[model samples]
Structure formats: structure tokens, C-alpha cells
Target: YANSTASGGRRAHVFNCHTDLYLEEAERHGWLIQIKSMIDLFDEGWTLRSIRKRLKKDPTCTIDSLGSPSDRDITPLRQGPPQDELPDFTLDEMHRQIVKFIVVDDQAINLIECPEFRRLIRLLRPELNDADICHRTKLRELILNAF
Candidate 1:
């Protein structure tokens, strides 16, 4: 037995909605739809897998695979990568290139928008050696705004 019972007034670990499961459950009852990756669900909240699951009456959000509430009750997760772990931007005049990359590559822009990215720049500010401070500033500003 699945420890769950008929949906009407049944208290169980999970529900067996039996139809349009995802769409109907959230429509009728309180759904704790947890978002896992903002990037994954950027344009649309539902994916192909989610859509298929919805057809099977699994419309509500995935029960967070994350563990007990108290487990996360201790502290919020950190926002970005560690400060010290960024790659050394050591190639001669690489600042110009990285700034150019920031303007163009969406992925690079995502990385640069990170607070860690911001921090890395600040950390290495003294060592930047003035390849082109104006260009670097413009690039940083562009990245931050796009973020």
C-alpha cells in the first residue's frame, strides 16, 4: 500500500489525483509549487516533462526533493561562487577581451552578473594594471544592467 488513500479528506504523504493531476490539483487546492532553477523555467513555467506529467493529473509543483523543513531552517543559501576560486585573468591585455565577451556572450554575461563576478572584479581591481579602465567600467556596467 502506498500510505496514501482516496483524496477526499485523506491525510497522506502524497496525493493520487487520478486526472489532469498537475493542472487540477493546483487549480483546486493549495499547491506548494517549488521552483528549482530560474534559468530552466525562465520563459515558461512548465516544461515538456511537466506538461506530460500534467496530462496524468500531476499538475501541482514537485514536492521539493530538498529534505525536511528544519534542514533548510538553519540558513539561506549563498548567492554566488566563492571569491577566491575564480580563474586568474592573467593573459596580457585580457581585460579588453573579457569586457568584449561580457558584451556579447549571454552565458558570459550570466557569469559576470553574479555577485561573485562583481566581487572578483573588485578583488582584482588593484592588479588590473589599467589595460583600459574606461572600457572595463563600461563592460561591468553593461553586465550589471543586463543582469
Candidate 2:
């Protein structure tokens, strides 16, 4: 009987006494199989096989390739705009943003809030009110006449 509030959002990891305790074994084994399958496919390629043969050794691990470079060269790409030097992008500053990007004509806007159109739409989908077949068929006739 585990209490819901006892752990305070912490997860309980129960260790198996008889078997391996390393939690990351399943994740590592999956990655190992994926990498081995990729390598097997690479070995099947004639060009890659020839390259491997020319090297006279199995491919070295590429996992360490992205480690810190020995060269002390560091290039800073734009030391970001100083403090409040950047423009304000908050909603208050963007009051005119909608007007700048959107241009809706009168007819399209009128259709959205038109009473007649709303009534027609409600009649077309009368099943929303759980109306019977006869009532729904009568509403359909009125909806067709409105157009």
C-alpha cells in the first residue's frame, strides 16, 4: 500500500537483490543493438568495405570526435545585444501587429456575426438539440430556402 503523498513527487527505485542493479542497462543495450545493426549495414556497402579494408582496421569510435578541440581558438558569434538594447516584443508593444499583418474585407467580417447566417447554420445542424427526424427535415427545407 503505497501512499500517494508520502514520497512528495519523488520516484521509488526498487533494486532486484538477485539480478543486475544498473538501471541504464536496458537503454544501453537498445543503443548497442541499433549501432551494431548500422555498422553491419555499413560493412555490406562495397565502397565503405573498401575504405575499411584500406584503413586496415575496424572503424574507430566516433563518440569522442566532438570532445573539446585541442586548438584554443574560440570565435564568439555576436555577444548578444547589450541589456535593454533589443526592441520590446511584448503584447503591449505589438498593439499594431495584427493590423500590420492581417487585412480582412467587409463581406468576410459581416458573414461571421450575421444573424440570418447563424440561424441557418443552427437549423442545418438541428441534431445538436436532439430534434426528431421530421423536425430536422423541416429545418433543412428552411436552410435551403435561405440561400
Candidate 3:
């Protein structure tokens, strides 16, 4: 079992295959109802089939799968006052940040070529296409133009 607490103090308990069977047994004994009342929580669209599919794909996957906890731990399934929508940054703003990282932080211009980095960018800006991602040459040009 894995427990996660959201920023809003909402706690989610994720049970593995073994714990899932235990929950079934507990429900048979009328314990699940009591547990549910105490937690004031219900399912958030995760069905057994979906869980199995996830487990099949990634045996170590967590239900609160946001990203690696090293980067950020976001609980998208929490119940609370809806999170404020983040203001969208324009393409220029994104390019500026990239340039800043490359120039100020001495980040490699080729960092954008990393698959994980590209995946993160896609996740953050789903509307952008592959062509929209600036390559190392474009980054070099951007640095030259900025200076």
C-alpha cells in the first residue's frame, strides 16, 4: 500500500494487488464501509481492469502517478476547492526561460534534445508540435541573437 497526501491535505491510499484482495475480504466482513466513513473517500475512476493494465505495463507504478517524486509530486485525483488554473506562458516566455537556463545556469543547449525533457515540454504545452521545439541550432541562434 502507498499513501499520498496532496497539497490540500487530502490523503489517498493506493492498495497493491495483495492489498486489493485484503480490501475485498474486509468488505466481506463489513469493514470497508467503516473505513470509507472514516476516510470520507470514494473511488476516483480507477477500476480493477485499469489497475491491472497499469500494473502489467509498469509493475512499480503508483496510483498517484504524476511524475518521478524527484521532480514533483502532484496529486491530480484529490478532492478539494479546485486548484487555480496556471496562467499560460507564451512561446516567447518559454524560449526566454530556455535561453536563461542555457546562459545563466550553463545548461547545455542540447538539453532540449533529451527525450525526457521533450516529453516534459509536450506535457506542459500539449498544443505545441514537434516542430515548435527549438533544436540545439535554434538555441545557438537564439543565444547569438540575444547577445
Writing each residue's lDDT as its tens digit, candidate 3 over 48-92 gives 334434545676665445132232223322232333774369887
How many residue pairs in model 2 have overlapping backbones? Answer: 0
- Count of steric clashes across candidates, in order: 9, 0, 0
- Tell me each candidate's RMSD, in Å, in order: 17.2, 23.8, 18.5
Candidate 1 regions with alpha-carbon error over 4 angstroms: 1-72, 90-131, 135-137, 144-146
Model 2: per-residue lDDT, tens digit, 1-147? 012323212212321221122113322222121223223433343222232233243344222222322232232111212345544554323222222111111022223244665565458555432222223244334323432
Ranking by lDDT: 3, 1, 2
Candidate 3: regions farther than 4 A off: 1-88
Candidates' C-alpha lDDT: 0.37, 0.28, 0.50
Best-first order by TM-score: 3, 1, 2
lDDT of 3 at 112: 78
Q: Give the number of the best model, judged by lDDT.
A: 3
Over the stretch 82-111, how does candidate 1's per-residue lDDT look in tens digits? 346556565534544464444322233345
- The TM-score of predicted model 2 comes to 0.15
What TM-score goes with each of the models?
0.21, 0.15, 0.39
Q: Give the better candidate number (1 or 2) by lDDT.
A: 1
